[model samples]
Target: MSSIIKELVSDPHSSEIISLAVGMPDPFLYPLDVFQRILENMPATNPSDFGYIATEGYLPLRRTIAHMLSSNGIETTPERTLILSGAQLLVLPTEAGLNLEILEDYLIRYRPKLFYTVSTYNNPTGQVLTEQERRELLLLARRHRLVIVEDDPYSQLYYEEKPPLPIKSMDSFEGVVYIGTFSKTLIPGLRVGFLTGHSALIHRLALEKQYVDLHSNNFSQWLINFYLEQGYFEDHLNFIRSEYKKRRDSLVKAIRRYLENNVHFNVPGGGFYLWCKLKGTITSGRLLQEATKCGVFFVPGQAFNARPTEENEFRLCFASQPEPVLVEGVKRLAKALEILQKSKTPRKISESFLKPIV
Candidate 1:
């Protein structure tokens, strides 16, 4: 959430940080003019409408999201959908997808109350759970009587074929709590997200949420619902999808051209990150030190793991920067890697440069 990268880049703050660290959308792409128009022309509301509303968020917004989810195959009613932004559990992934055997093993041993995951274009790693995996996972959860928190913020940003229907879309057990956010899909500033699950569970969660903000921002919820209803979101999604794919491609090309075999990375089909492994003996911390000197920064993979066994991994986000900037960051990252390889003594980042994140 330290939006230091885009904020500093646009305004040219004194901070010398050129961050590829954060996993947020570029501010430049927000449809500000359209937002202003939506506001200026918004219909008036009652005085109470601006005050405390339902803790589950604006009713219209919930219904709107319900319809959207149903159309996408995750049949849910407004009663089962709650508006909010949210996160949990770490699962080590494989090239094929999530390691189902490991998760089942963990479940059988621990019988954990909740299992959380990103079944599509997962953050940091960009791995996805195949349809088979999703179905099998649902069965496992059902057998264990365990609940799943499926965080799916990046599915809409796919560059390849649309990923398999969300696990929630196929949750016959009604145990998958599907979470989505407009923060990535529509507007970040709004900070609006939605969760759909069992109606009883949603009510319990909503009751707990009541003490937090009393309710989500009424205005933002109303606006987003209108945005969806007027069909503004589809066009916006198409625009971002095209642009982010270009940035992803640019970052991939830059990494290969500069870093080459010094590092190993997975080229994600979508999502914002390029999860990389340091091929040499250098740890991510040492490389970050060199990278910082080069005016680039990334979150080390260790930060994402609770029980990190190695320090050779790191994450780079591609959605936060423009194509040229992504390439430039990668170039700087390559320089840092080079500096790390060549010198034990701390050295300056040569004037030349170039980097991504989850």
Candidate 2:
């Protein structure tokens, strides 16, 4: 689990603590109506609903996902989509803005078989790769015989214009594997996510999964199938987009009002995080300590760095909290910064400590 998520889950509701740590979706947006409808329509007691599905996942859901990917410009068949349970690992190019020059050099030196990225509205940074960068990555992957894994779970949560098309949508998508999820769209409890790629690869993955969990929950799959088929997913997406945008705006406003001079950050066009760089000497670790004292919590930015870390950066998430709570959290963060700034005193050099150099 991510350090941010661990912090959120452990002691989630302390008396006065306001957490802007995790990217968890707002529980207030749960689509009770759609799930209620699906439950009402489901047979009261059906053995098939409890039976094990194919290792690849329920066929209907796979088919739905295939069609959805096709619309997104990733031409795939149901046989090509591998439904997975989770994902992990981290390493990235050194150059900022996802520099392809560094990426190609790393690819050549490492000769890695697979490359992975969050391409759209990246976690923590909220930076979306430009189309030109995506194209360059695809070309490099093809030239070097490397597989690209695109984990995109936030594409649908944009507050501004939609982000660039997925790399899997490119004509060179044959070497690209795309992963997406309904966990954010519906609810995380649903545990529904899928991977799209060549049928041959999907087949092998399914074979491996069969030995693991047998299959994902069949009952949940049926509910998702019903939700998608009945067109509830689209309505739900629209609803949350509006609500989350409000929360994003609220956090941004509060940060500007309270921490603007002390910190610097770009407003995200979409997704759950606000990455902030401190303008002072306060390290994120120290800030987190003081913020905890001020009744707020956020992850230090060093947690996300692939190399040696500067201590001045941290991430704040606006999606999990209500608008009022989001604002309060920022105020608490500001309070923490003020406290830290005031508490620091410059060390004075004593004449007794200074020895004359001969």
Candidate 3:
């Protein structure tokens, strides 16, 4: 089994418990009214509006997304964009069989050909690559003539500072395929995401999509278009950023106070997760099992790595739970650690032997 799956299975009640293993955003934070308005505004009055759209996606939605990308310094046109179900779907299939050797600098010598990366606020780990790392990876891709697929769903949700420019912005040769999703910022049920790359590549992907699902739902595309045009998405994103930031802060402070000094992790600037490394003899797998017994659960760190390593780490979500719940959860996690520490103590036996009773 994969290391992550193994760690999860090690949980005492792996079958039944609260889960922090997944990377989804908080449901309560979804922009329901904005999507509702968009749905209500769909031009069902015209039969053509409900029909199949071009496999590339709705023209206007693509245009708006292109505009959003350009505004962020990617310098791309709508013709270069292809809408997809979600960022992962867009990345997984296209990235298969690609050569990572092309970008040797960006990868560890043994890095997998396909990288399921989360450039900013990576799923589970929440470690955003530094600007220097981003440039090195881009340059590596260019030198090797390899494709670098950047999955950036959490860039906009940062709490402490502005997010770095997406790796797409550095693509002078159109070597990077950028996948973005609105599920985290907007409502996930919309299942709206887009892929941006060279026009030729996008055209081929659209063709593949045509044979598969024909096209995305026209009504949903139209609804998203209307929502973008109305300028409600920006305001909604700001509101989400503000509220999620507060929750993140609460979790960070609690972890610092309740967790042992040996547990180390970097505080994320914009994303929803906190990645932690436990110290000494305890492994993340063991901690997860103990945490479950105390009513706290989190994903083991091995899930993010494409291969196994010696590290004992895991990820915790600060955005999903309310502040009070987050605080309580950390306290319970601390209690679990105490139990594990005590279990490791060596018991002292009497030097003198006593006679046995009949």
Candidate 4:
């Protein structure tokens, strides 16, 4: 999928080809000037700024994260938040660590074990776990002495209504670990993200990070802090939200008007993807091949699932393409589907019957 996206990007005529393929905010929406200004203002501080800082991340960035989370109702101390490269790294190891911590906590509490998660809009799906579902899962986790790892990267890109609070906010038992990233909301190349959890678990993870990168990019952290402190980050996020929502609307409208009923998908509230399930006589692989012929591409859903199945599905990212391009891409996809449907033939199978021994 990455190679396909790369090929699309490398093609001189790629702009004419609509790409619902790659995940990332449109370049037009980036806060380039803000970032540039921050970079331009960087002072030649101690050699350590160019060198390694703390493994957990620079103190200012960690404090900023704590303040940001606190404003959203998550009371995270700097000690309980460890900066990482991005949310993916923050989530994977933290999830593994949470599993161990939960087991140990459960053994001490003499309780059963449980783990609840949103694994759909999960990465490529773009679906957020609903509020009621989140509450119910938290209740179950609490009852069973389990931990909830709410890996929310796309929650802030909603099309309608405000985003829900992090599940960590509802953790009376301190069983929720929330991971967030600037890669999606801010700039991808910055590689800045953080996680919130109990101090003990975070401290252990910080030690683990010490062996990894020693710390996240101090210059990047300083740049982010500078941007946020200057009050440009929120404005930047607002711009991104507006642009992404517009693009998402365009993709949905185009799909509804041009595509047939053979394709079905959920319109996510926020995030970068549309999880499409093909119906009747079409496979994702064939659809992809046809789309490629038309110079369009998307990721097949099997890559996101732990256990691959015969399900015919693919993910479409709208945030990476403009409205006109997305519409054109969807049109290409609709045309491909029509072609595939026309080429399919029905097969009849007869069951052999043995007459009763007469």
Candidate 5:
């Protein structure tokens, strides 16, 4: 996880590299005006502002987040929402996002209490589950009496078509637990995330979190609340989507022109990644080594798989860099592919190849 993000600013090759490894918001696009306004309006030397609030979080922020989620189709209230300094762990490891049948099979085999997924613009794959798939998944969860955890941080960052309503929205049995974050749409430095679902579940989580830390930073929550109130959140979202769409298109065109038929890929409707598969015999480990040498880096698909590694597959993100940088990154990746294909022996796999990107 850290490996992918580390490449963003801390990579040794930052000056020369055109890295498309991390799926992060472009810092240049942050709404500094909104921040300034929020700061300017802050109550100077106020005592209550810095005081610790409930583990459940500040009421206004939770209510606002609940309203936003409701408008997007996920129904919830502040009471059911739990604010967290970090996201709740959903530890079901799978090769890919859960399919209805796969989920049911796992439930039967493992008698697992919950199913977890990133349904829209999925992390490394950039794959969005279809409406029908979402419906069936919910149905299966109901039938199995299982909990479904929907980790949806990227649904709002769409490129072309709006993604299907989250499985949480479609859940009729109240079996879905929805988790979201401001890290992707907003800046990552603002570490705020929330969970919504059964009030009992939230209460239990809140109780556990109380021991971890009294609560998240009240100032950060208030800052985001002010950003939302100013009506800049929506505007900022629209602006980033347009900019990201351009970068997405650039990546698609660059891959077509450079990698040619050496790889197979799907253009995502929304999200930061371009999931790709190698057409040749070279493994993703070899490709990464070669690509790194060419001043580019990518997360191999094997890192996301729960079973054996799919060394022929890899993910390239187009969100962090601008269009020109994305184009250059793709070109470097192509050069790496050429070198990998031409090499007769496999290169030594690096330990970093096993690190998951999202």
Candidate 6:
């Protein structure tokens, strides 16, 4: 992902390169005009809020987050939450959803210090664990006294019906830590996020945070809080859902129109990706190279897996482009697949791409 971003950034030919690899909100959709109005109307000097505040976060913002979480069925308090920049997540393997049998064995064998999950509208895969699975995961953590970290950044971006409440909502044993951010819904530049967990855990995390960056940006927090309080989130969220769903449908239609016989994928109800697999001998690695040459890009499944894999799976994000561009990208991908299928000596990735970012 870093190399792809670097290539796009450094290369003079980047304008022609279509990237479907990164999970990002489109700049075209950012509410810059609304934000300008909000900023223009703000007070120039509010010393208390502008200066260094509590390590936890702005009180009104934390209170707002708590209220929002409660509306979604997750009981929280400002005392149980902490302001954060973002989170560090490690991806694990899955099909349409998590398999508890394999998860149980892995937990017993590895005895990991912490287990992390995206749970809803998962990145790269667009998989959402069912409510029963969420409950079972909580049960597993309770049984083993394991710490389950739930980082749900895409739950609110669903395209259709809402996904099940996060595992943290059903966490009866205080074993789950839930993370939320506005990067997807609002804007990434705000750099505002929060973590909800047991008060004791949040206290320790807050102390550790004081040494790192002290606290999250107070101005950004205030901006988001004001935005939320003014009832603009739901309006912006509704627009995002409508626009992204159109692009998602366009990408799906294009793929089906061009690669139906050679590839297969699940059309996610919500989220930004279509997890795909080629049916023939064309490997994801070879397709990736050919696709790059064809001026289209995507993330191979190897990057998301925990172990070395030879699967032909790949991820394509539709949110970063418009309907026409998304269709054109699929056409380019189809051409790349055609090139790979015709090549006698198909190349493969010599090194792994599963290395962590951030």
Q: Which one is best on TM-score?
A: 5
Q: Please give the clash total of every predicted structure, in order.
A: 11, 0, 2, 4, 0, 0
**Model 1 lDDT per residue over 106-223, tens place:** 4664454888889888887899999999999999899888888899999989998898899999898688989988877776668788888888767766765776667777888888
Q: Which portions of model 4 miss their true places by more than 4 Å?
A: 5-17, 43-47, 90-116, 119-121, 345-358
| Count: clashes, candidate 4 | 4
Q: RMSD of model 4, in Å?
A: 8.4
Which parts of model 5 have CA positions greater than 4 angstroms off? 1-13, 43-46, 86-112
Q: Weakest 10 consecutive residues, lDDT, candidate 5?
A: 4-13
Candidate 2: where is the Cα deviation over 4 Å?
1-7, 10-15, 43-46, 86-112, 345-358
The alpha-carbon lDDT assigned to residue 342 of candidate 3 equals 82
The 10-residue segment of model 2 with minimum total lDDT is 349-358
TM-score of each: 0.86, 0.85, 0.82, 0.84, 0.89, 0.88
Model 1 misplaced stretches (Cα beyond 4 Å): 1-16, 86-112, 345-358
Model 2, 174: alpha-carbon shift in Å?
1.0
> Which of the predicted structures, 3 or 5, would earn the higher lDDT when compared with the native?
5
Tell me which residue pairs clash in candidate 4.
Answer: 55-214, 121-125, 121-126, 121-127
User: How accurate locally is residue 26 in candidate 2, as Cα lDDT from 0 to 100?
Assistant: 71
Query: Please, what are the lDDT tens digits per residue for candidate 6 over residues 1-358?
Result: 4566566433323568897876767778989988899999985546789899999999989999999999888899999989887554323345579978756754674444687888998887889999999988888888888888888888998889989988988987788889988877778778888999888778866876787788889999988888888889899999999999999999999999988898888889887788899899888877887888898877888878788676788888788788898898999999988877777895656563433221
lDDT of 5 by residue, 113-142 (tens): 877899999888888889999999888888
Q: lDDT of each structure?
A: 0.78, 0.76, 0.73, 0.73, 0.81, 0.81
lDDT of 3: 0.73
| Pairwise lDDT winner, candidates 1 and 6 | 6
Which has the higher TM-score value, candidate number 1 or candidate number 5? 5
* Per-residue alpha-carbon lDDT of candidate 2 for residues 53-77, written as tens digits (9 for 90 to 100): 7888888888888888877888888
For lDDT, candidate 2 versus 5, the one ahead is 5
